[model samples]
Each structure stands twice: as C-alpha cells, then as structure tokens.
Target chain A: QQQVKQSPQSLIVQKGGIPIINCAYENTAFDYFPWYQQFPGKGPALLIAIRPDVSEKKEGRFTISFNKSAKQFSLHIMDSQPGDSATYFCAATPAERGGADGLTFGKGTHLIIQP
Target chain B: DVKVTQSSRYLVKRTGEKVFLECVQDMDHENMFWYRQDPGLGLRLIYFSYDVKMKEKGDIPEGYSVSREKKERFSLILESASTNQTSMYLCASSRSRTGRGETQYFGPGTRLLVL
Candidate 1:
C-alpha cells in the first residue's frame, strides 16, 4: 500500500498551455503530499505541496489539487513555459516529528513545452 | 537556506567493487535521506536517519546499507556494486516539524555508473 502510481509518463504542450500530471496512492496514512521538479543533471526540487485537509494549494503558477477520498493528487501548471519543462515527481509521507519517514515517490512525468 | 551537499557529482565503479556515497547538510536538520533515481522507476528510498547513530531501512534497502556517525552526515554504501545499481543518488535533509508541513531540501545529486 506504499505505492504512489502516476500517469501520463510524458506530456507535451505549447508555450502558453496548461499541463497536468496526476498521481494516486493507496496508503491512507499519508498526510503530506508534495511535488518535485527535476531538471537535467540536477536533483529534484520541491515545487508545491498540499495536505489532505486542504483540497487545493496554489504557489505562483503551480498548483496542487488533492482529493482525500479519492486518494489522489495532481499538479497543474498554468501558462507553462519552456523553462518549466522538467521531470515532475509526486511524493507522499506519513506525518512524523523530525520527519522520520522518508518520502515515497511516483515514477515521474516528463513534461515538455514547445515554443 | 538549507544546504545539502553530496560528495561527488559523477562517479564510475566497476562491478563487484565497493562504493560509498556521502551526504552532508549544513542546516543541522535532524532527518537525512538517501534515494536512487532511475529513468522509469522514479526515486526509491534506500535508507534514512532520524538522528545521529539511528538508521532505518527504506522501501528498497536490499543491497544497500547506511551510516550516520554524525548529525550532519549520512552515507550510502553499496557493498558490491553491480551494473543494475547505476543511477542518480540524491541526499535530502529536513527539520523535525511539530506540525504537518515539513519540506525536504535536496542536494545536487551524484550520478553513479557501475560497469
């Protein structure tokens, strides 16, 4: 039940389009959900995150929509630009003091925005 | 800003050789994590340390081991390197949180090639 399944392994869009990546988990214990963005030859960076208590979170042009009952979450990029092209990963962790548990990551989605 | 640093940006090792990947964080975060990222497999946790001298095995810890001799350092060891172990290694650190919103800071990552 630790698996976080992600879909649309790859996505292509125009410079001003919206690209969405989706992920689902079966573990009910997960309380924190985060999305990470990784560029070529770089480590993944935290993009945006959401908790099960909140249905949605917006950070700049990035947003996270979470569904508690559906056990799913999604990342939406509004007005995606070429600079936003990167491999995105969805991760989850059970809440712990001092962050004891390591994050469980999805397979990843490769996003490309054409000019 | 939290700074997580890895020992190397790229490494090459022969099969059957022993390898060590080191990570250090300057933020004095209590939690440290080691993960391996592959093309289609995403990021898989190898191990984590909640505190000095305390280590825990993650989801895919079969052929790996970890060391946390100090609060600032964490190491991932491959006793016998294999071709299948080639991947991008990431180290992350996070502060212990009283609430549910904890974010992890990642290093630049080390790319290992086992021949």
Candidate 2:
C-alpha cells in the first residue's frame, strides 16, 4: 500500500509564477514532513521540512503548508525560476522511529519552469 | 556539510551476475540508508543501519541485502543481478536523533543497468 500519495506527476509554470505540489498521507503516526528537490545528475537534496506542530514553514522562496488535521501538505515555490525546474518528492516519517528508520516517500512530481 | 558518495555513477552488468553497490558518508552519521528510485515509484527504502553491524530491512528488502561494517560505510548487494533490478540507487545519511525532524543528506546516486 502506498502510505503517502503525491499528485500531478508533472507540472509546468512560467518563470516568476508559483508552482504548487501536494501530498497526502494516510498514516496518522507521521509527524515529520519534508520536501526534497532533485536536479538532473544529482541526488535529491533537502529543500524544506515542517513538523505537525506548525501550520506552515517558509525558507526563502520555498514554502511548506501543512494541515495536520487534513493529513496533507503542499510545497510552493515562489518566483519559480528555470533553475527550480526539477523533480520534487515529499516524504514522511513517524516520530517514534526517531528519525533513524528512514522515510516513506511520494512518487515525485516533475516540475518545469518555462522561461 | 554532509557528503555521501556512491561507488559508481553508472554501471552495467549482465543478468545473474553478483552486484555490489558501496556507499560512504563523510559526516560520521550514525544512520545510513539505501533506497532505489524509479521513474514513477519514487524512492523506496531497501535497508538502513543505525550502528555498525546493525541493519534493518525496509519496506522493499526482497532480492537485496546490506552490510554495515563501519559507521561511515554501507554496502548493498544483489546476490544475482536481474534485469528488473535496473534503477537508480541512492544513499542517504542522517544524525541519529530521537525526534520528529532530521535532515537527510543524499549521494548523487548510482544508475545500474542489468542486461
């Protein structure tokens, strides 16, 4: 069973526009939600993360809006640039695992910013 | 900065051959993970180790095995390489912490093609 599900297998947006990718989880035990960005020829890197305690968290042009009650979270890139075009993955983990048990990841969304 | 390195960026092997993929982390992190990334399946954990010689199977551990003889190194082995095993393999590392949030650093990934 896919515990975590992500939508829009691909996305395209113009430069300076906001591209939003969303994910949902069925496991309530999940408390840590993180977004990763992957550029071609490189591994996915930690872009931003959010805990269930917060409704939203922002870092630079990247923002994570989390709804614990809804068991959903979304990543938004502000002023999207061509450099930001890549694959994005959303992952979740339970706190009881202590961040050592690894994570459950979404299938990923391929984003493209048309310049 | 945490650096995770995979032994190879691209490797081609014949079916039924034994395969070994090595990963090394420079951050001395206590937690290391092995995952296989596919086009539409995202990233699925194969195995993870929290300490030397201690390993745990992840969601999809079938047809794969891992060894962690040192805190900074982890190895994934395929007893007999199969065409179905062709995919991009990623290594990740993180600090062992008892919490809900932790950052995972990933390697560039090794793309294996089994014929």
Candidate 3:
C-alpha cells in the first residue's frame, strides 16, 4: 500500500488566491508529516510540516492543517504567487525511528499559480 | 544551512553496466538516504544508512546496494543497470534528535539513463 496518497495531480490557481493540496496516509503509526516543494531541475525543499499532536501549523505563506483521527493533512498557500508554482509532495514517518532513516512519500501534486 | 551534494547530475550508461552514485553532506548528520524518482512513483527509497558502515534496504532495493564508509558520505551502487532503472536519484541527510521530528535536506538529483 502507498503509505501516503496525494490528491489533484495538478493544480491551477490565480495569483493572490489560495491553493490547497491534500494528502492522506494509511499508516497510523506515522507521527510526523512534512510537505516538500520541488522546482524543475532542482531538489525538493521542505516547505512545511506538522505533527499529529497539533491540528495546524503555519509558516509564512504556507500552512499545514493536520487531522489525526482522519489520518489526513493538507498544504495551503495563502495569496499564491507565480513563484509558488512547483511540485508539492507529502511525506510521513514514524517518530523515534531516527530521522532520515526512511520516509514514505506521496505522489507529488504539481501546483501552478497563474500570473 | 545543510548541503548535500551528489557527484553526478546527469549520467548515461549502457545496460548491464555497473554504476556508482556518490553523495556527500556538509552537515554532521548521522543518517543518509538514497531514493529513486519515477514519473508516477514520486520518490521511492532505495537505501539508507543510520551511521557509518551501517546500511539498510528500503522499499526498492532489489537492483541496488549501498555503502557508507564515512559519516558524511553515502554511495549507491547498481550491480547491472537496466532500462527500467533509468530515473532521477536523490540523496538526503538529516540530524537525529530525540523525540522531535526534523526535516531532511536533499541534494540536487542525479538523473541516469540506462540504454
């Protein structure tokens, strides 16, 4: 089973609009959730992350809303700009397994912000 | 800032040829990972090392092997490259802290084409 699954293979949003990408995970043991943004020809960068203990976490223009019972999380970009266009990925991992050991990743969602 | 560097950005190899990909990290992270990215598969872990001289198989490690001789370096080896193995390879490293989940820093991917 794909430990994590992302929705909307591609997303298009007008500038200044809010774009949301959702992800659901199968493994209940996962305690940490992170989102990565990847541009063409570059490595994916961590955008935002949330732990199951919290319902939401926000960093700058990006926010991660997590639902523990639902086993789902989402990334929401406020006032989306063209520069925000990139492939967004959601990933999960069980805590105490040692960070960087292994992470289950979701199929990326290509987010496009229109100018 | 964490910096993970891969030796090759793009490579072309003949089928059945032995291939080696090297990765180095600037941060003194105790963990390192190698993953392959396909069009639909997103990122699939191939191998990971928790400490020097310790390696573990990931989800897709059938055709791959890994070496971790130094704390900052991890290497992925393909015994016999095949066309199906052609994909983008990524390397990542992260610090291992207690209880808290941390984000991983990634290197620019190495794209390999096996013909």
Candidate 4:
C-alpha cells in the first residue's frame, strides 16, 4: 500500500511563477514531513521539512505548508527559475520510529520551469 | 558538509550473478540507508542500519540484503541479480537524534543494469 500519495505526476510553469506540489498521507502515526529534490544523475536532497507543531515552514525560495488535521502537505517554490526544474518527492516518517526507520516516499513529481 | 559516496556511478551485471553496491559516509552518522529509485516508483527503502553491526529491513527487502560492519560504510548485496533489479540505487545517512526528525543526506546514486 502507498502510505503517501503525491499529485501532478508532472508540471510545467513559466519562469518566476509559483509551482506547487501536493502530497497526502494515510497513516496517522506520521509526524515528520519532508520534501526532497533530485536532478538528473543525482540523488535526492533534502529541500525543506515540517513537523506537526507548525503549519508552515519557509527556507529561501522553498516553503512547506502542512495541514495536520487533513494529513496533507504541499511544497511551494517562490519565484521559481529554470534551475529549479527537477523531480520532487514528499516523504513521511512516524515519530514512534525515532527517525531510524527510514522514510516512506511519494511517487515523485517532475517539475519544469520554462524560460 | 555531509558527503555520501557510492562505489560506482554505473554498473552492469549478468543474471544470477552476485552484485554488491557499497556506500560510505564521512559525517560519522549513526544511521545509513539504501534505497532503489525507479521511473515511477520513486525511492523505496531496501535496508537501513542505525549503528555498526546493526541492520533493519525496509519496505522492500525481498531480493536484497545489507551489511554494516563499520559505522561509516554500508553495503547492499544482491544474492542473485535479475533484470528486474536494474535501477538506480541511492545511499543516505542521517544523525541519530531520537524523537526529532533529522535531515538525510544522499549520495550521487549508482545506476545498475542487469542482463
């Protein structure tokens, strides 16, 4: 079973436009939500993360909006550029596992910013 | 800065042959993970270790096994390589801070093909 589901398998946006990717989880045990970005020929890297305590988090041009009650989270890139084009994945982990259980990941979203 | 290195960027193997993928992390992290990434499947954890001589099965550990004789190195072994196992393999490491979600750093990834 896919515990986490991501929408918009692929996306394209104009430069400077805001591109949003949404994700939802089915397990209530999940407490940590993180977004990862991957470029071709490279592994995924941590972009930003959010915990249940906060409803939103922003780092640079990346922002994660989390809704604890709905078990959903979304990633928004502000003033996205062509360089921001990559595959983005949303992942979750249960607090009970103590951060050692590894992560459950979404199918991934391929985002492209047109010049 | 955290650096995770994989043994090879690409590899090719024959069916029924034994294959090994090695990973090393320079940050002295206590947790290490191995995952497989496919076109539509995203990243699926195969195995993880929290410390030396310790290992745990992730969601998809059916055709793979792992070893962590040392804290800095983790190895993923395929007992009998198959065409279906051809995919991109990734290694990641994170600090072992219980209860709090830690950021996971990833390597460049190894693309393997089985014939």
- State the local distance difference test value for candidate 3: 0.91
Evaluate candidate 1 and give its CAPRI docking class based on DockQ.
medium
What are the DockQ scores of the candidates, in order? 0.70, 0.79, 0.69, 0.74
Model 2, runs deviating above 4 Å:
none
Error of 2 at B13 (Å): 0.9
What tens-digit string does per-residue lDDT give for candidate 2 at B1-115? 8899999999999999999999999997889999999999999999999889999999999999999998999999999999999999999999875655778999999999999
* lDDT, candidate 4, B17-108, per-residue tens: 99999999999999999999999999999999998999999999999999999999999999999999999999999988474787889999
The top-ranked prediction according to DockQ is 2
Docking quality class, candidate 2: medium
Query: Fnat of each prediction?
Result: 0.68, 0.78, 0.63, 0.72
Shift of residue B96 alpha carbon in model 4, Å: 1.0
Name the fnat for model 3: 0.63
Q: Write the per-residue lDDT of candidate 3 for residues B1-115, one digit (tens) a residue.
A: 8999999999999999999999999989988999999887789999998889999899999999999999999999999999999999999998874546778889999999999
Give the residue spans of candidate 1 off by over 4 A. Answer: B97-99
- Per-residue alpha-carbon lDDT of candidate 2 for residues A17-98, written as tens digits (9 for 90 to 100): 9999999999998989989999999999999999999999999999999998889999999999999999999999986666
Tell me the tens digit of each residue's lDDT in model 1 across B1-115: 7889999999999999999999999998888999999888999999998889999999899889999999999999999999999999999988884546578899999999999
- Tens-place lDDT per residue, model 4, A45-77, is 999999989999999999999998899999999
TM-score of each: 0.96, 0.98, 0.98, 0.98
Model 3: residue A71 alpha-carbon error in angstroms: 0.7
